[model samples]
Target: MRSRSAPPTVRDVAARAGVSPGTVSKALNGTGQLRAATRDRVAAAAEELGFRPNHLAKSLLEGRTYTVGILTSDSFGRFTTPVMVGIEDALGAGRMSTLLCDGRGDPLRERHYVQELLNRRVDGLVVTGRRPDPRPSLGRLPIPVVYVLVQSDDPEDLSLTYDDVQGAALATEHLVASGRKRFAHVSGPERHWSTQRRREGVGRALEAADLPLAPELVLLGQWSEAWGRTAAAQLLRRDSGVDAVVCGSDQIARGVADGLREAGADVPGRVAVVGFDNWDVMVEAARPPLTTVDPNLTALGQHAATRLMDAIDGKELPRGVHRQPCDLVVRQSSV
Candidate 1:
């Protein structure tokens, strides 16, 4: 029934509620001191009038756009997608929108996107994946920046990353409890945080069991099936005594199992295999199923969003590297 010539505004809402525009603003922004009953009246009237605030005008007055920027590497990666979904859901609940920028592992492209987001006046920023160190000057930006699934050079910067250390520990401990003592590791890139944490976790478990890892038993390479094949081949050829294998990822574990089968090794009979990143699609179809750790990336993303919102709300957050817990799923591969 309303005319299309002019859309409803704060003034319209105020007029409908029998209050001043200032009172309407206070109730909507939750800033100025306003009685709860009066605020409810203003909100109800605004809803009835179908009044949506002029975001640009409100931002101009408050010097904030209430927008958050999310920077991700390889936006289509399986692991990154769930985390992003969590961020989106949390931000939406907070009544904020996100601008996503995919770096695709390009430093120059990342820098450009950061600059663009800043120019658009995003109130906060969240960067994902391992990036070339953010420019030292990024600290000077007026908005808060948080890192997810990656480590940043700035110690003070907020980061929520996968607890790879705990993930590795759980995998290794499971193998040990399954009565497999002789162990080997098929690892990813040496410089990767995941690879490093996994290695450390394995070592801790071994140390706790009063066992020492043989240098030849540790196979370090990339997060690829090809590397898994090569590492599995060499490991079996050199030491046929290994009773278990801990793979850096589900992909790597698949290749390792394939190679072991070709070499006539009885999976879970003579050797148990455990991997990281349950990576459900590939894992569900893997032969003999895979015992792997679930990084809980979705939960990690949600946590990051919650943390960022807390910071925005001026709430005291216990700041440090927060590592989300990982779950070890049992399956045929390690049975």
Candidate 2:
């Protein structure tokens, strides 16, 4: 047995794997070709001996800092938290560390953080915004970049956002399956691209089911519960015979549920309510658990990290926006 005073080294791992130090180095660094069995044996031997590579030497040899940076305009808010976790998970497997910078939507602060990250020599960057709207790119930088949960307006930069149209279409399809005919949409600001896409989705689904497009029943409001409550009241006042309502977010859905119940409508019976972004806190707390569309934010981040890593490795990837699919979660609100 080796003494606790000394750490296991590559030489020890090579001895156990029955390979020379040169071969061990190649196997660990993933450099020269080696038989799969030899690589597996060396890996197992290293794991058993608790052998770790000399990162300093590895960095010197590979000319990489083995670190990545994520810059978000949200200041690490709720929406960006899971994305960061996913990024870390993917980068860690590649022996890379992560650095996160929050701009809080300040242009000066964003520039400052960008410079800071560059000074630290991160291998690449991942950029995101609070919303799915497109924002100006970070311009051509020395490192590669991938955008997630948001997009860079520049056509040359790689960007990713959820398929809002598909998500909303699924939500509407569920409501239709539940026997809802007359429908209303309560969503965020009319200016938001997400809201516009969701509205289009709802319209398309309604058309597909041979249902009325009831554009008059749709209400454009803030992305908050207050707007939801107000819109619900307005919807009831119209006496439009609306049997189903689709919302842009869980917050709005929760408020709509409250308003409708207070105004004497049977949730999921007299009316079905479906929401987007299946946010747990707002959804679960709603009178009936809110059925919602999940954006799979973590998965989006994971894919973004993979794209950035590929770019760093000199792989050619297509630029422009890539749409990630979303899922609809059913609950009492939309059963």
Candidate 3:
């Protein structure tokens, strides 16, 4: 029988390439200073020898776990899933793994999870929440911390949040340009930053069009479809002259459209409707494809990861809220 061959080691590759083990390590781990020619040689030798570094041993030497921590207010939320996918894809491309923790919207639990991540010596941290608030304690952590889909408490902290103001402006402008003068708004939770920004954008757009926002036409409620239905019914009952309805979210828009249809109103023909948060699959599958704002949640996650990675590499990122742009996806709902 043939003798079993021993697994290749970093030492074998370094020797074969005529370079020190340290140089080979630096080239493989994407760290340290090594000449291009030497790095290439080591890489070629490693491939030939089938050398794979022991990750545990490497972590021990570098004092880095090569793991990132992600904390979300609600892991099962529709918006959180796609954003997490984007974050994971970006981090995986960098050869990093993630440890996810769900806070369930509890501040105490969030604080506890942060401490646990720190204790594990995570390479970086990502925090996701609906509300934007200053995070003074995060700055004290030794590793980099990034806020995603939320604003940080401190103005100087790094964050990646959706451009709700721009999204709402685009939606409202589209309606105004299309000759819809009498506009109404169906909003989400009053306390949400996204809700406030979106409402502000709509208000600004209406003001620019020289049309005052009719207070009776504005309806504020939760982010649920039920709330949208109720609000839409109430608005229609109270204001029969409204030509359009701007929704804070796609889910709310869906409800509004349903309510209108039930009331014998033809969407886009009688009353045009627009909403934020693209929600492609869900919104696209609707009978009348919904016109909504694509918040680019995936891009938001990827940008946050990139920023955190740069900070880890000793790069200086400009501090403050980093707003990612939103695109309006036109569909049948808005015509």
Highest lDDT among the candidates is held by which one?
2
Q: Please estimate how well model 1 matches the true structure, expressed as its whole-model Cα lDDT.
A: 0.82
lDDT of 1 at 159: 72
State which candidate, 2 or 3, has the greater lDDT: 2
What is the TM-score ranking, best to worst?
2, 3, 1
lDDT of 1 by residue, 203-291 (tens): 99888987768888999988787788788889988898998999989989988887887788888798888888988875777776899
Q: Model 3 — which ten-residue stretch has the worst lDDT?
A: 130-139
Q: What TM-score, to 2 decimals, does candidate 1 have?
A: 0.83
TM-score of each: 0.83, 0.92, 0.88
Higher TM-score: candidate 1 or 2?
A: 2
Model 3 RMSD to the real structure? Answer: 3.0
lDDT per residue for candidate 2 within 5-50, as digits (tens), equals: 7989888999999999999998988879899999999999999998
Off by over 4 Å in 3: 1-6, 14-23, 30-50, 131-139
| C-alpha RMSD of each candidate structure in angstroms | 3.5, 2.3, 3.0
The stretch of ten residues in a row with the least summed lDDT in candidate 2 is 75-84
**Index of the highest-TM-score prediction:** 2
| CA lDDT of every candidate | 0.82, 0.89, 0.84
